[model samples]
Target: MSQDQSDKGTSLSLEQILAQAEQDQSVETDYQSGFVAVIGRPNVGKSTIMNEMLGQKLSITSHKPQTTRHRIHGIHTTAEHQIVYVDTPGMHLGGKKSINDYMNRTANSAFADVDVILFVVEAGRWTKEDNAVAKKLQNTEQPILLIVNKVDKFANKEELFPFIEEIAKEVEFTALVPISAYKKINLPAVEQEILKFLPKQNAIFPEDYVTDRSTRFLAAEIIREKLMRTLGDEVPYGATVEIEQFMFDEDEGRWIIHALILVERPGQKQIVIGKGGQVIKKIGTQARKDLNNLLDARVHLELWVKVKENWSDDARALASLGYNDNYSS
Candidate 1:
């Protein structure tokens, strides 16, 4: 075995290591790989689940709904399989802005080409939005794995039965797995279920690859996540981040990033900047810490807020801001 496989084998129990060897010998190193789309309403923990499964954070997350604006591919590779998880924006209703349309369109399109769909829903809570997602998936041929997330919220396990029954009536899922993305509960079962449906094939991406998005895109997302967590209720919906300059300064041995935070109204810009620039300064500090982890090097980040005046609602402006449907690695 290769050194990489040997390293992975060291973590397994003796029985598990033997099982792995037996399986490898039986299949003669057969590999399974495919795409899995994570779909749900806002704040249902779709991104969190994907991040946990990949053993790292690839998608930006916040308590705010619609935080994930773009489709991201979080690729997880092991010796046996490669699962490219497609993380999508939450599907919601009653938003007419161009950005809203873009988010919903990005989510809808993700279901088309995926090998499996992880339909995530909060345990004991089903809304019109969840119903809408279920309705949309009524005729899809791909295997739908109903992930009843956040079950840890319930103190008693029996309480979940009723909610599970309710969900069973709504979605015709191939399998139902209860989990808590936050608590890391039953996550391994989720992976096992997904493997059952994946087709046997060669790896789709290099084993060292973790995501399909550019590092610059992830930096912008990290900045936006800080903005979403820092700003108030209304401002985050109208706010977006654009990376103006991203480069490695060899002399300084640090990555330098200049980001512009755009808002639809001037008041929102003021809210982001705060009374004495304290809020934006805090945002910059938080984002810089995450950027240091993401780049594995010192980062010099500069942030500025500007009034873009309905950039979220203008198609050309949205496209310019990287909201286009053709966005790719």
Candidate 2:
């Protein structure tokens, strides 16, 4: 037996493994493909669940609410099913700005024709935001899988049963599964539940594809994530990231990315730039490392903090920042 086979929990022979691999390469008769929307209020781990399902870090994560402000599509392909997970911004009822209105519309628009919905909430706790999310998602015919996230943080495991029961009373969830999206607990079960609703069809995308976003978009998001993590409360609610330039040199096997960190005020810019440029340098370093890993090429990143006042409230400003969602739902 080969070392790979020995490491695997299965004791099948090499011929059997190869045969299975060949058989599982791509079968169209029973193949499945559909979209699954991960929706919930902010900080409830909706992005975390999408990342775990796709086994890639495409969406940004931060302790601050509203970290995800757009709809991101992350794809997961396997032998039997291809699940296109749509990670939407947290649906909230708190703001009146155009940006907030855009975010709310973007999230609600994802429910048009999805095969399944993952309504994620923190384990053993319920808040008004949760009620609001449930209310918004009401009257949908599609099946919803209630994903109770952060189960590892719960003090007692027994609370999960009653909690699931309590949440079930609010909406007719097809099923409820407690999982820690951060720790990847019970992920296979979650995957199985979603696959039950997928239609029998061929893959919608190339087998090796992972996402619809380009490298420039991902790089800008990486920088914003670092800024959100490092600055925390200092990062303004209207903060937005834009890629000024992204260039690649085939001969040099390198990439050059120039990005602008847009803030609403001078003080926020000062905080982002930091004293003696330490904070900006740290953000560039972390973002470069991730960019290099993502592209498998050396990245030279340049960051600049610029002031863009009240862009969140202006309609034209939101469009210029690429907040439009023209998905063919």
- Identify the leading candidate in terms of TM-score: 1
In the range 188-277, model 1's lDDT, one tens digit per residue, is: 999999999998867666566677667778889999999999988999999999999988888988888999999989899889999899
Model 2: how far residue 112 lies from native, Å: 0.8
The superposed Cα distance between candidate 2 and the true structure at residue 127, in angstroms, equals: 1.5
Query: Candidate 2 — worst ten consecutive residues by lDDT sum?
Result: 1-10
Candidate 1: global Cα-lDDT? Answer: 0.87
Candidate 2: Cα lDDT at 277: 99
Q: Write the per-residue lDDT of candidate 2 for residues 134-222, one digit (tens) a residue.
A: 88778988899999889998778986788777887777888878889888899889988998888886766556657666556777888
| Residue pairs with clashing backbones, model 1 | none
Question: How high a TM-score does candidate 1 get?
Answer: 0.90
Backbone clash numbers for all candidates listed: 0, 0
Best by lDDT: 1
> Deviation in angstroms for 269 in model 1?
1.2
